[model samples]
Each structure stands twice: as C-alpha cells, then as structure tokens.
Target: MYHALLLLVQKLSYEVEEQIFSEVSLAIQKPESYFEMFKDRLDERGIDSPIDELAWISLVDSLLDHGLAFEIDWKESGLYICDVVDELLDRKNMACVSWEDFEDGEFDELPTSLCLNKISGKLKEQAISLASLDIESDCYVLITVPSSDTDEMKALAKEAGYSIQDSF
Candidate 1:
C-alpha cells in the first residue's frame, strides 16, 4: 500500500510537469469535494467508492509527500471547518519541500523532499520514497516523513529549518 502511494505521488509529480495532472493544492484542500467532481470521469467506475478510514489516513500521509498535509488539533474549543485551512496554510509553521529548490537528482538518487506514513504506532523506514520533480516554482509544499523517535525527528526538523512538532 505504501509503495502504491509512493508511485501515485511520483506519477502525479510527472503529471504536474507535463501539465497533465491537476494541481496538488486543490487535491489536498478538498479531496472529498474533488473526488465527487471527478468520480464520473474515472474509467474504472467499479473501483470508485467513498474514502474509508484507512484510505483517508493513507491519503493524508500522501498529501505530505506533496508538502501539503497539515496536522490539526480538533479538540480545541469551537473548532470550525475554516480552521482546517488556516492551520494548514499558515506559512510560519509549515515545512516546504521542493526538489528543484534543493538539488537535482541523478538516477537512483533520492529527491530532497520525501514522504512516509505510519500506521498504528510503528514507523517503518522503508515506507519512505522521493518525489520526482522539475521546475523551480514546483517546490511550494510541506511534507512529513517517518522517524524513529519523536525527539530525534524534532531535532531533525529543527536542523532542516522547520518548526514541526515531534511525532511520537
């Protein structure tokens, strides 16, 4: 499943370069809305179904690869739907990953920005994969990845110049 998600992201990155795919921002901002809009356009209609819990979780993780996922704390008083966009688009705390903004990749080389999602409480390193990217402005997104420990990840994030909280 993780591999599949990685492939999807990589494919989407190429699609972006080719101008054949829709922008990542819209997809991350309103996944359900967009799904409803394009549900009929899909060739494999039988495989289409409402996103399940597992699917949403994985989708959120994939959004990170595009550097578009934001962590939300819904327990706060009087949370509203608008708050979701506010929390995610806030430039102060967001971590932007751009493949071109960092360095070019050779064959077998990893892109500077990568994404990994963990299920349960365990983080698996092999779940990580790089995005295939080109173009300078294509670098405007935030992403999350797997780490062994919360403290260690936090330290790494700090070193990388992002204000991300430790993921335990």
Candidate 2:
C-alpha cells in the first residue's frame, strides 16, 4: 500500500503534487482517515492493474501529514514526491519524465564522451546520466562531482544541444 502510494505520488506533476498536497493537508487534519481516500483511489486503479497487490492500507499507527516516502527496489532510483516537484517548478534545465513514458521504453543517448572531465585529481571523472529525483537546473541528469566540475557539465550539456536556462 505504501509502495502504491509512493508510485502514485511520484506522479511528479506540479498540478498533481499540489492536489495531493491539498488532499493531504485536509486528510491530516482528520488524523484517523488520513489514508482512506488514498486507499480508495489505489483500489480503483487496481482493476487490470499493471502489477499485482491490491494493497489494503491498514494500520495507521501514526499520522503522515507530510506524505510517505518509499525506497522501492523495482526501480534503481529512489522516488521522492516532493523533491521532483520542487526541482521541476524551480529548475529550468530539468525535464520531467512520467512513469508511463518510462514504460514506453523510448530513450536517447547523449554525447556521454564529453562527460570525461579531468578535475583537480587529474583523474578521468565520468558524469553519468539518469532519471533522477535529486537533480539541479545546472545540467541534465545527476552530476556527482565537485563544484568545479559543474562548468564542464554545463559545457557538455550546451554542446549536446541542451540550453542553459537563465530563469525558470
């Protein structure tokens, strides 16, 4: 049930997130029926569902006024309902990909060779690309390197036809 809610909230749309947040804000006020509406919604989606497990959201030991975060093994990346929303609304260079779009399996490869950057260590540090929740507007995908490497990432993104967004 928690997993289903996680996947649903990972909807990642600003509008949807706002709706969920509004619903949560109201539901949290009730304390007892916090997840009742969520369960009903999930059950409705269970008919001919993509995956199994018609999860009954029982045992609400505590209130989840802030919403639940689930780290599922189904996908290698952890899905955060809030982080994705924040970056999408505030960041200009970032793109939002829906779970359904992912299911379609359409993809393109960037010029990854440009990711090879020789930072201070003089070691060839490779910046990888992925569908990430913890993302920034500086460049597409998650660049896990020092601040110095951001220039290289921006260069790579621009060279790859990705625009450097001045404002969102």
Candidate 3:
C-alpha cells in the first residue's frame, strides 16, 4: 500500500484545513450518495443490488483526478479513505507539489534528491508564482509524498523555513 505525507507549509491553521475537508466532504458526499441511491433502482430492475461501494469508489477516484481529494497514509493497510479538501489554503494562490514531480527515473536516489535546498527552491518558485497573481497572502507549499519519506520530508521542510502543520 502506498501512503502520502501531506505537508501544509506557510499558513499553518487547522481551521483552514478543517474547512477545506468539510466543504469537500459535503461536495463529494452529495454525488456519492446519489450514486448509492441507484442500488435500490437496480434491485427493482431485478439486477444484482448493493453496488454502492463500487459506485462510491468510482466517484471518489474521479474527484481525486480533479484535485478535489488528497491521499494520506493509513498505516500498513492498503484500505483507507482519501483525504478530501476544497482548498489547501484560504488564498487562491497556493501551490501544490507532488513528490512524483521530483523523480528522475532513479528510484534509489529519489530520497537523496528531496533535500533542503531543492525543497526550498520549489517553495520559492511557488511563492513567486503566487506573487504574480497579486496575492500577498502567506505562501503555502503542500507536498504529497509516500509515508517512507515522512521523516526526511519533515527535516527538509524545517530547513526550508516551513513548520510541519499536519501529517496523515
């Protein structure tokens, strides 16, 4: 099972994170339940019922593709709920950085590449992009990386002047 460490840097506020989760949950839940409602209709049509699970999973996968959901680690078990969020920060200028973007085909040396300087550079780049949008709000760099890289990620984040806000 693969897991991701959600590093919310810059503006560290639980309220913002919780609000994002709440809004996203409500948004996805509506469509998810709508799909679930089809089970009864299928049953009435003499088809195998209880397709709720599959339907819900499909809807969630679609949401993930559209950046409406974030993946977080769930110990060693592969079964886990994806983290849903409406936004990473209150500002519209926030940037999201995924660990996959840093991969250079050398899986063995991937961790070594996630160093302080590189991570900080990425953050700076994101900040600059936000600035161009006339956004003076605190810049945030959210990273979604595997659980195995949590510790190293934390260390690098600290070195990059970002405090660890939350991890799942």
Candidate 4:
C-alpha cells in the first residue's frame, strides 16, 4: 500500500538516510534505474510479495508533501504549457507528451521543476525560504530544500558528498 511506502521512507530515513536519499533522488533523475533499485529494496522490505511496480510514484509524492525530499529539475518550468499542446493537437499537428516521468505513463508533462517551484512559492507566501542548493554545480537550476535535507542529499552524490563521510 502507499502508506507502507511512505512509512518506509520516513521510518528508515534517519537510520538508512544514505539509501533512502539515493532512492528518492533517483526516483526523478533516473526512474528506470530508480525502479530497478526500488524494486530490489521493496522486496527486501517484505511489504509486498515479489513487489512488482507498486504505487512507488505515490510514495515519492508523499515524501515531497512531508518535506522529507526535494528534486533536481529544469528552471524554465514556467514555459511548460498544456494549453499550447492542446491547441496544437486541436489543429491535428503531430505532437506527443509524456507523463512517464511520474510513472502514470499518461496525462500531460508536469515537470518536477514546476512542482518544486510552486512548492517554493507557497513556502515563501508563508514566510519560509526553502534553501536552493547547487550541489552538482550545473549553474542553471539548484536543488531546493532546507539545509538539513539538502545536506543529506549532498552526501549521496559524487560532486555533493562531503570529503569526510564519518562526519556526515
């Protein structure tokens, strides 16, 4: 069930922060790989027998909702417009949209960048400034979250990990 996945993320986050962060981070960055890794881990959890592509997508969504995870994504997310695609399609123009990113494999493309930005905007309206960190140094878009969360994520990547792992 979705609840089990959410609990697995939160309950094991601190105890297994390294693995947890890696899976959540990869869920968006490399879903195919993420799923391969996730399925293996899910099988280990004993949550479901032979765990074949469970509602892992919802698990990721729940993680963001609880501020337990953040995503690396495009910054020009504002440019994504479903209406334009719709109008183009109305004219019978050849076009294709993929929601495979979220695993539904349907619906319009909703980039994680736009979703994360909207989350930042909502936090700002509430006087909270979610930290935008540049662990990978792409210089285009930064991973957005608070210091602690980002710090954990930083430890998972080659460019972001601290030189001293014992401290992390």
Model 1: per-residue Cα lDDT over 11-70, one tens digit each:
323223222223223344565665665455322323264443223233333444344444
Tens-digit lDDT track of model 4 for 45-95: 343432233334334333433334343344323323233222322332223
Selected candidate, larger lDDT, 1 vs 4: 4
Q: What TM-score would each prediction reach against the true structure?
A: 0.21, 0.23, 0.22, 0.23
Worst lDDT run of 10 residues, candidate 3, spans 128-137
The residue ranges of model 4 lying beyond 4 angstroms of the native Cα positions read 1-67, 79-121, 139-168
Kindly report which residue pairs in candidate 3 clash with one another: none
| Residue clash pairs of candidate 2 | none
How many times do residue backbones clash in model 3? 0
Tens-digit lDDT track for model 3 on 1-168?
001112321122233545433333432456455445444543543435333233223322332333433333222111111011114222233445444544554432433223323443444444411101001123222333333444554554355433333321
Q: Whose lDDT is greatest here? A: 4
Instruction: Name the lDDT of candidate 2.
Output: 0.29
lDDT over C-alpha atoms for residue 158 of model 2: 46
**Predicted structure 1, TM vs. truth:** 0.21
TM-score of 2: 0.23
Over 45-85, each residue of candidate 2 has an lDDT whose tens digit, in order, gives 34232222222111111111222211112222222322432
- Can you give the lDDT of residue 37 in candidate 3? 49
